[model samples]
Target: MTRELTPKGSATRQRIIEGAAAEIREHGVAATTLDDVRTRTGTSKSQLFHYFPGGREELLLAVARYEAGRVLSDQQPQLSRLTSWRAWEEWRDVLIQRYRRQAWDCPLDAVVSQLGRSTPGAQAVLTELLNRWQGEIAAGVRAMQEQGEIDPGLDAGQAAAALLAGIQGGVVIMLSTGRLTHLEAALDVAIQHLRESRDRHPADH
Candidate 1:
């Protein structure tokens, strides 16, 4: 699971994943094909199989993983460097802008649902993504705690888990309704709750 990919191989695989994601986003997963991805990536059949031995299904899973990572990667530095109120404020804006623009695509839901939520690999990919995301949130929590800007009594892990759950729930609702209100509300309320927690112990913070 931890193979070292040569830079070229890594780049090629990324190209394939991005290509596949684009195809799926545009056509839906069931309608997209290996040939579509092949043409999109400019990859020959041999080159594609070389990177994904299990064929189209394997490649689909890979693309799913890539999209999942992207859900977090798009929020970087602001998400990772949450050391102050300013950083969280910036992150809040980024989060709003991200979903506001993508409200129509809902690519993650479109593709992942097509991949079958019951598949073990699919579930694992989602679980891993959530864990990494929560870890990032927890890291931000700890950063504020260490800076004496947040209450040490604040359970960072628990807080992060709850926040992630809220985000996921809000995202699901957004996809179902094609509205950003729930997503915006989730983030705003979550951050306000955290700020309230900090305010409760201002002498400590």
Candidate 2:
């Protein structure tokens, strides 16, 4: 069931989640506790329970959603302003730099993995974030197509999906190897393919 909150209640809930995130970032999800969140956020136990009626799991899910939002936020306005080739290149560098700075430490993933992606709230947050992100990318590709910057024949949906898949795969590899090779290779191949595909259209030159 969805929990409804008043304006003040909503603010308090957000405070707890933000505090929880900070605690998790410092000591990880396994080590963060309800008391820590309460103390950190300056919220009382009753106040905490008022917002998180379902308790720790529910709070973690909310934080999961918040962190998922960050994943996309970190990529903007570069992602949002991809109307030209230069914008795409700039966005690519931003993407690479963001992940490079976050190596070996996916705190959000740590929490979600513990919560189980199969959980309804967790799954919904991820699905929405990914779909929205991919849609933005697809829109950018379409905009470039309309500007005659890329091949009009290019499938925007497929290209965007491929890009998102590559990003996810790259992140997984980075998590496993503590390096950016996978991400760099994925972006390099995808971008190279895009450039080559554009070249294939005679009028694209």
The best candidate by TM-score is 2
List the candidates' TM-scores in order: 0.91, 0.94
Clash count, one per candidate: 0, 0
Candidate 1 structure lDDT: 0.85
User: Candidate 2 residues 49-140, lDDT tens each?
Assistant: 88888899988988888999899999999899879878888888999999999999887788889799798877898899899999989998
Q: Candidate 2: minimum summed lDDT over ten consecutive residues — where? A: 196-205
Model 1 residue 151 CA deviation (Å) reads 1.7
Off by over 4 Å in 2: 1-4, 203-205
Best by lDDT: 2
lDDT of 2 at 65: 88
